[model samples]
Target: MLARVRSTNLAVPRPDPGAGRTTGIDKRPVDRIEVFRPGPRYGDGPGVVGDHVGDTRHHGGEQKAVYAFSREELDWWEGELGRGLPDGMYGENLTTEGLDLESLLVNQRVRVGDEVVLEVSVPRTPCATFQRHMGERAWVRRFTERGRCGTYLRVAVPGTVRPGDPLEVLEPPAHDVDLRTAFAAAMGDDRAARSVVDAGCLPTIYHERLARHLAGEG
Candidate 1:
């Protein structure tokens, strides 16, 4: 994998990537997301607040997109990226400053918007494309084990959201049932596997797969 880092102006994130900085991605918190297509709920502006992500192929809801992270993860990213993680550099939507991504446990409850609560599901495991982008040596699988990678979320209940909005954790995870645990349990007892997946709030396909595995069909 090639570490395609541009010059400081291009590579590094913008305007104080500090954890508390809410202006840009680098400063944002967990439960993070950027609206490529701000839908109906999102008002028109440069980085409007209380906006909706819009519709997708699978899930349907007024509030479309969501993101998450912790203060520690942002700091960690700064260390990993070797500077401020500039916006629009690596295609990362939400910067998630100071949130030690490695510590973001599975099944963690990441409240995106005020009323839009979402649970952290599976880590964003790097595919070949990611390998090409980051290096193959980037240790993509480590993210899965550490639960450092961000998870895709489906809206449980719709709510209005905006950039710079504070992300809250309505419910914290009960013990760290990270991806490692999930994979392990999945390979072990069927019911345990199913339980772990359900508890993690994984994507529907994963949840269904676990259910099937529990039924002894897989």
Candidate 2:
């Protein structure tokens, strides 16, 4: 089934107390986001529209410009966490529906609305900020084991996007590497992780970590 953008969220770089440290992970909802062809600072810099990211070292850039989480997954998390996970609560720029986000391949291209096109980049790695945000004990471990980490996208085409926009998959990469596989590799399996790096589908943002894993340095 074709997926649709259920809701869109944006926020300027702001201090997030709930971020549990000096992290800019807290994003508030905004009306619209003007997307642009990705660059070094596509999601975190001034040129992009309404959406802004807190951390550049690990969060923003062409490879992870737009973070997307499926409402379906959120529903599941809500059940597990025993509470409602409002849209944007996870700091996702787009809350999608009808898409199997976990299965999307790295380098897959998806068209949103009439202009914005996004290339799937990588699976989000849950961090301490995320655990603090949710206030759940063992949140990171649970989230990692659950393996439903949402996807990050690089803006391939620029345009304005809003809630309820149409979403279409333009193409999927010709590789076996998927979000879960990469996640597992990063966690420990050098063989699995090296495959993802060798596939050349994942952006450069992940190379350093993968290299460390392969070299027993991570």
Candidate 3:
């Protein structure tokens, strides 16, 4: 089956007393969104024009311009949590289908619709805000252990994206550092961390973290 966007979502303002004054974790489906490369998280917010990104310190930037989660993974979460996980429940901008996000290698490129091209940059890391959003006990731990964290994309070619847009996943990169491995590395797996560092092509922040990990500093 061809990969496709099941839904496009934009943030809905909600109070988050923990980190940012407000949270954009509650995203609702939208008809369409214009994708672009927002330079950095501190100033340039979400790539999807008009989407809210309350926590700029860690989210939304050129490397994390877009976040995508697959329906298959959501289904698995639904079964695990014994609750319905609607599209965008995980704060992803695009709810995709027919894609094994975990298997996608870092730097892999995907064409959305007819114009926009996104490069897989990194895997989403679970934070306190995410745990609070899910309202599940030990949500972070569960998510980390699963190692099915969604993929964050960099807008290589900007354009409009809408529901049902066909996703054309391009060929894999030379390295074999898939999202699963990356996620594991982020969660402190020594071997996975080495693999990610060896693969290279990661964002600078990740490189720094990997370096620290290798040096027994992280």
- Candidate scoring better on lDDT of 1 and 3: 3
TM-score of each: 0.47, 0.87, 0.97
lDDT of 2: 0.76
Count of residue pairs whose backbone atoms collide, per candidate: 33, 0, 0
Give the range of the ten consecutive residues with the poorest summed lDDT in model 1: 2-11
The number of clashing residue pairs in model 1 is 33
Each candidate: RMSD to true structure? 10.8, 2.6, 1.1
Model 2 steric clash pairs: none
Best by TM-score: 3
Winning candidate number (lDDT): 3
lDDT of 1 by residue, 1-218 (tens): 21111111111233322322222222222233333333323232212233221212321222223333333443556686566544332324343442343344565655554555555545444443334344436545644344444433334554544445545545566665664455445444454476666674555666777777777788
Deviating ranges (above 4 Å) for candidate 3: none
lDDT of 1: 0.42
Q: Is candidate 2 or candidate 3 better by TM-score?
A: 3
Instruction: Give the per-residue lDDT of model 2 (tens digit) for 129-196.
Output: 78877889999889888888888887788788788888898766789788778777666667878898
Candidate numbers sorted by lDDT from highest down: 3, 2, 1
